[model samples]
Each structure stands twice: as C-alpha cells, then as structure tokens.
Target: MNVSIIVPVYNEAKTVERVLMELVAVASNDWEIIVVDDGSTDGTRSILQTVCQEIGVAVVFRDHNGGKTAAVKDGLELACGRWVIFQDADLEYDPRDIHRLLAHAETGHRVVYGKRRGSWHRPNRWVFALGVLGVDLSILLLFGRFVRDHATCYKLIPRSVLTSLQLRSVGFEGCVEITAKLMRSGIPISQIPIGYTPRAMSDGKKLTPAYGFRALGAALRWRNWRPCPSPAEHTGSSSTLPAKRANSALN
Candidate 1:
C-alpha cells in the first residue's frame, strides 16, 4: 500500500461519518483507512457502520478512551502502507490533501507536514493561536529549529521513520512528541501550505491552554532521546511495514 490513514476518534459523532465518507472518496484502492474509536461514549461506534460497508476502510474499537497516541499505536500495528498519515475525526482538515501528501512522498520526502494558511474564527482563534505559538516557540527553543507548524494536524510520515521515532504521548501532546523526536533525529520537515476552517470551543474542539503546556513538557522530556533498536534493525531483516524495522533514508 502507498499510505495508511489512521483516523482517531473520541466523541466526535457529528463529524465522524462525514469525515469517513470524504476519506473513502479520496482514498484509492491501494490506500487503507483505519478508523480507531477511542471508546466513544457518543454513538460514534454506530456511525462507523458506514465505514464497514466502504471498501479500503477498516475500524478498530478500543476498549477505553486512550487518547490519540494510544489509538494511533493500535492502528499502526495493522498498517501495511509505505507511509502513514493521521486524519482527525473533525472537519478542520481537508481530505483532498491526502493526494498532495502522497505526491510529496513519491518525491522521496520522508517527513511532510501540511502548512495551515492561517487560523479563522472569533475568540476561538485567539485561544488556538496563543496555544500553538507557546508550544511551537518552546519546541524551537529546546530543539534549535523552527518546525513551521508542529501543531498542524496534517503531518505525513514514512512508516519506517515513524516506527523509529519511539513515539509516546497522549492526546494533543502527541504532536509535540513527534516534533521533538524528529528534531533530535536531525530530520528536515517540509511544509506545504493548506487551508483550515478553525472550529470554536463550543463546537467540540478539544485542545486547550493546558494541552499547550503539556505539549511543551512532552517536548522537553523527549528531547535528546534516541530510538531503541527494533529486532529488524539488529537482525538486518528489512521486514515489511507494521513490522519491526529501522528508519528509511530521507531524500
């Protein structure tokens, strides 16, 4: 497969169905879309029945509400794509950009993040802007590199590179985990500007000022850490993706 798209959902019942439909429309036969339900208290699980009927789509219902990181880890084990990307259950991100990310990967860019054009909305924009700025600036100071937008939800990573990142974090902090580890690994991140329709807090937007602080903490804690060697790295087996393996060489 070319890319595996993992959709991590909590209680996003309103938008989850539409998101899955958009993904199914955008995905080619070679792509696999894995929808992970993080023990939704809402009727999201029922909505995912639509996903089961769609081809190239699969759903995994977690036992409990384990945040984005844990849900992704669960889906990653089943990924067979050369590259992997995360799609939030909300409507903030565009699904058509999946092809844009894949084109970048075809050009051999191992790590790519979709650059948001800008934030739009009222007081909600202020909240989001401040939190993103705080987390981004903190990571830049700690890692000596400006990542453009570490808080962008449209990060595209090679499956091999992702496996070697030793990613660990829950909720929004997972973004910080990926950014810090990649900076420490000396990987260059290429950003492509895209559109975003920012949502308000009342619209079920989960990120908050506390998430920003936790993200900064995650970045500080993970900085300078190296990825532990997987069995394939030691044995030189070079197994398929979702299998234990070392990182792929970047362009």
Candidate 2:
C-alpha cells in the first residue's frame, strides 16, 4: 500500500460521512482508510459503520472514550501503508489538501503539514493569537524551529518515522509530542497552505485553552527526550473485514 489515511473520530456524526466520502473520492486505490472511532455516543458510530462498510474502509470501534492520541495510536498499529496521514473527521480540514501535501512527499520530504489559511472563528482573537504564539515559542525553544501550526490536524508522516517515536500523549498534546520528537530526530518538516473552516464550541469543537496549556507542558516535558530506534519495517497484512466484523475484533 502507498498511503494509510488515519482518521481519528469522536462525536462527529454530522460530518463524518461527508469527510469519509471526500477522502474516498480524493484517494487512489492503493490508499487505505483507517477510521478509529473513539467511543462516540452521538450516533457517529452508526454512521461510521455504514459509511466505512460502503467504502470498504477499516473501522476500529473503541469500547470506551479514549482521547485522540489513543485512537491515532490504534490506527497506526493497524496501518499497512508506507506513509500515514492524520485526517480529522470534523471536516475542519479539507481532504483535497492531501494532494498538495503529497506533492512534497513525492519529492522525498518525510514529514509535511497543512498550514491553515484564512481567518478562523475565535471567541477571542487575542486569546487565539496568544495560544498560537505560545505553541510556536515552545517549539522554537525545544527544537530551535518555529512551526506556525503546531496543533494542526493535517500532519502527514512516514509510517517508519511515526512508529519510531515513543508517543505517549492521550489528548491534543499529542500534536506537540509528535512535533518535538520529529524535530529532535532531524526530520525536515514542510508546510503548505490549506483551507480551514473553524467550528465554534457549540458546534462540537473540542479544543480549549486548557488543552493549549497541556500542549505547552508536553513540549517542555519531551524537550530533552531522545528518539527511540526505528522498528523493523512493518510487514503486517491489512484487514479486509467489513465494519461489523472489525468492530467485533475490537471487542
């Protein structure tokens, strides 16, 4: 397989099907879709079952709510592609941007990020600006590089490099953890501008100021950590079971 699209979903019933359809439309046959439902209770699970089955995508249903990091880790464990893209199921980020990110990968870039363009709907612009500044400053202090969107959900990482990291975050902090590890390992990260449509808290947007603080803490905690040795190349076969059978395996 060429690419493994790992979508970590929570209560995204409103947008999950549309996001999956967009992914399916943009991705080629060699690409595999792995949707990890993090114990969604808003009928998102039922929607995923139908959509994933219709598209022949692999869906892993968690018994209880684990955070985004845990859902991503589960999908990574089952990925059989050489590269993996973390795509959010909330539809904030566009799936078409994957093509733009892949353009850099084709030129030997192992890590690529989709930088958000245009203004976002923020409750307080100053607070959002400060949060972005905090994350960028934290990354600069830890890795000596400034990453504009440290908490972006559209990071495309090589499966080899991704599996090598000692990832331990269980929430939004995973973004910082991954960035710190990649930068410390001397991986060149490229970025491209992408479209973004931010959702308000009332629209099921989960990020908060508390999550930003946690991300900053995670960056500090992992600054001095060394990268683990890369594991032997994964040779596992991809699962072809229907969504129902896949959920059964999760149990």
Candidate 3:
C-alpha cells in the first residue's frame, strides 16, 4: 500500500461517517483507511460498524475509551502503508488536503504537518491561538526549530519512521511527543498549508489550554532522547488489501 490514513475517533457519531465519506472520495485504491473507535459510548460505534462494512475501510472497536493516542497506536499496528497520515473525525480539517501533505512525502520528506488556515470566522480565538503559539515556541526554544503547530492532527509520516520511534504518549500530548522525539532524533517537520473550519465547544471541540500545557511538558521531556534504531525502509504488510481488490468506495 502507498498511504495509510489512521483516524482516531471518540464520541464523534455526528461527523464520523461524513469524514469517512470525504476520505473515500480523496484516497486512492492503493491507500488504506483504518478507523479506530476510541471506545465511544455514543452512537459512533454503531455508525462505524455500518459505514466501514459498506465502504470496506478497516475498523477497530476498542472495548473501552482509552483516549485518542491509544486508538492511534492500535491503528498503527495494523497499518500497511509506505506513508501514514492522520485525519481527525471533526470537520475542522479538510480531508481533501491529505494529498497536498502527501505530495511532500512523495518527494522524500518523511514528516509533513498540515498548517491550518487562519480563522476568518472566529475573531475571538486569541486564547486558543495563544495556546498553540506556546507549543510552537516551546519547540523552538528547546530544539532551535520553530514548529508552527505541534498539535495539528495532520502529520504525514513514513510508517518506517513512525514505528521506529519510541512513542509513549497516551493522551492529547501524542502530537507533541512525536514532534519532540523526531526533532531530538534530528528530523524536522515540513509544513504545508491546508484549509480549516473552526468548531466551538458546543460543537464537541475537545482541545483546551490544559491539554496544551500537558503537551508543552511532553515537548520538554524528550529534548535529549536519542534513537537507537534509526528510520529504515518498511518492506510491506499483509494487512492491506490489493489495490485491484479494494472496494468501489475506495477506488
């Protein structure tokens, strides 16, 4: 397989199916979509069951809600792509931008982050904006690399590079942990602009200033870590279906 998209969902019944449909429209037959239901108590699990069965996207139903990072790690185990990217169930991010980030990976960049477009709709997001700026500055202060959005959900990484990392974060700090580890290992993120549509707390937006603080702490913790096993080429995997055999929804 070429690209593997891992979608970690939790209580996103309203938007999960629509996001999957968007992914189907953009992803090629050779790409794999692995949806991990982070033990959602809502109707999301049922919807994913029906949607994945119909469209043939791989789905993993966790027995309990183990947070987003847990679901992400579970999806990674079954991923079989040369390159892997993440898609949030929330429509804040545009699925059509997947290939734009993939374009950088195609040209041999292993790590690509999707920079969200400015919010013209919400002018009062200074607090949210400040939290993100704190994350970017923390990385810059420690690694001498200015990463605009460490909390962005749209990082495209090679499966080989990802699996090689000693990923240990189990919550909202996942993105920050990955970025810090990569930078410590001498890898830098390549940024690509992508569309974004902000959602409110009433609309199930989960990020908070507390999460940002936790992520900043994570970024500080991994500054000096070294990788024993550097990134190597991944051979292949049996988890992915053949391109010719992929269902019409994915083709």
Model 2, which residues run further than 4 Å from truth?
A: 231-251
Error of 3 at 45 (Å): 0.5
Rank candidates by lDDT, best first. 2, 3, 1
All candidates' lDDT scores? 0.77, 0.84, 0.83
lDDT minimum window of 10 residues, candidate 3: 242-251
RMSD to the hidden true structure, all candidates: 6.5, 2.3, 3.8
- Model 3, runs deviating above 4 Å: 238-251
Worst 10 residues of 1 by lDDT: 242-251
Give model 1's TM-score versus the native structure.
0.88
Question: Can you write out model 1's per-residue Cα lDDT over 1-251, one digit (the tens) per residue?
Answer: 77788888999999998888888888887777777788988888777755444443567777699888888988887777777899998999999997897797569676899988755656768777877887888888888888777888898987777788866776778898998888777778888887787888899887777887788789879977876653332212222443222111100
Candidate 2 local lDDT, 117-138, one digit each (tens) = 8565566645655797788897
**lDDT of candidate 3 over 1-251, digit per residue (tens):** 88889999999999999999999999887789988888789899888878987887888777898878888998888788888888899998988888889887778776999988768557446777788888889889988888888888999988888888868887888988888888877877899888889887778877876877797788878888788776568745646342222332232
Candidate 3 C-alpha error for residue 80, in Å? 0.3
Model 1: lDDT of residue 116: 81
